[model samples]
Target chain A: MALEQGDELPELSVTPDKYLTVRYAGASGDYNPIHIDEEFAKAVGLPSRILHGLYGMALVARAATEAGGGPASLARLGVQFRGMGLPEQEITVSGTVADAGEAVTTVHLEARQGENAIIREGVAELRR
Target chain B: MALSTDAVGTSYPPVLYAVGREKVREYALAVGETDPLHLDHEAARAAGYADLVAPPMFTVVYSAPAIGPALFDPVVGIDFARMVHGGQAFSWGPLVVAGDEVTTTVTVKSIEEKKGLGFFVFESVSANQEGHTVCVGTWTNIVRGL
Candidate 1:
């Protein structure tokens, strides 16, 4: 793929569910109640069990990797958790090639669940 | 009590984790990844890897245990009940292949108190048995005031 600055990368949409969250909890070893127990989350003032922020970041990384050709192409990825991601919501990841260098390509990324921006200040660098 | 800034610069002992092919495949599937390199050993070998490769984020699975010391330190006084993940950053070096024995060391990078919340940064560096860096992950946690 010919990557260039100002080029928009393909968007990736992921709809997480309770089952996925449970599996992610087991896979990631992050058994935080806010992510696995709805009753605990509600008792703690959350609307419901929230998805792990790393999961959303992984989706963003997947978009970068897909656009860069493969997983090995991605060199760095960073994101700030801006808002909570609830299960069963379609989270959309979009990005633009911010800079394309001879050795690396930097892409600016964002992930949103509906109108709420769940991940902000996202950036990914891929080896060229 | 808020998290202590004194813990900054503390380093934990390296923890060893064996990356198995089945574990890698299970993580890839759980993350909704369908790439052949992560599931098929032959395909991965054809792609220049020794065996099934792990997804970039899979480092979190192996590195999570290394951070337990810092997160649960009594001196740091971190309240798990009020803490939330604030951010995450990763820099990859080499792909983690199946059967690779990885060692990770967790370090408390920084800690800051602001607006009644404690922001702590932890860095984990994972390297293969050959001492080649596999990945470095930085995790941020926010501990809200009670």
Candidate 2:
């Protein structure tokens, strides 16, 4: 779909499997213990291993690309980490086109896990 | 101890990344991406890309290594134990195709402490082998109870 003002990006709802952080760590080379080791995370005062914030942002990027029609259409992505995201819960990325210009369209994105907002003030620019 | 404000503007030598096809596939799978444009070479070619497409966030892989030096640099003095990923933003130029060699350079954009919290930001520029800018990334980290 050609995104225009007030268009909604395809909603992406993903539930991270138990090994998601482990797989993401290997693929992204971000082997931080807080994302992979449950024991280490609990030791550091977290409930358990937390999802990588980047993973959540990536989903936002994917949603924009999906709505923009292709990967090449995405020109920029910005996301803010507002709360911790745990595995096994539904994380949803949803957004609406805020401005549609001749050259670019701006999509305002937000991500959430239940009541917690994982990414707030998210934005994406797509070539129009 | 507080972060070293002087660390701002410290630049690191550029690092090069060979954008491998399989690695791109791994990342797409890890993120549970469904677009054939990113996963299937033929689909990407069908849609005008030269090869498998690298997701926009793939910039992280090329830029993370450079962030390491900035994170560990004594001049920056980040307390890793207390630091947490705060946010990320990227301005992309072109779609990164598999086999495109990308070079990333990072610099400490800012280090500031406010109300017992420390904020660190790094700016990175990634360019393709032909010297065209591929992406610019900004990474933010926050230290608690600083």
lDDT of 1 by residue, A14-102 (tens): 89876788998888888887889989989989999998888888888888888998889989999999789999999999999999999
The numbered model that scores best in DockQ is 2
Show where candidate 1 strays beyond 4 Å. Answer: B1-3
Off by over 4 Å in 2: none
The deviation in Å at residue B76 for candidate 1 is 2.1
lDDT of 1 at A9: 92
A118 Cα displacement, candidate 1 (Å): 1.3
The TM-score between candidate 1 and the true structure equals 0.96
| Local accuracy of candidate 1 as per-residue lDDT tens digits, B1-146 | 64467878889899999999999988888888878999899999999999999999898888988888878877666787878889999999988999999999999899888898888889999999999999999989998883
TM-score of chain B of 1: 0.95
Screening candidate 1 with a backbone cut-off below 3 angstroms (N, C-alpha, C), the clashing residue pairs are: none
Candidate 1 CAPRI assessment class:
high
**lDDT (Cα atoms) of all candidates against the true structure:** 0.89, 0.90
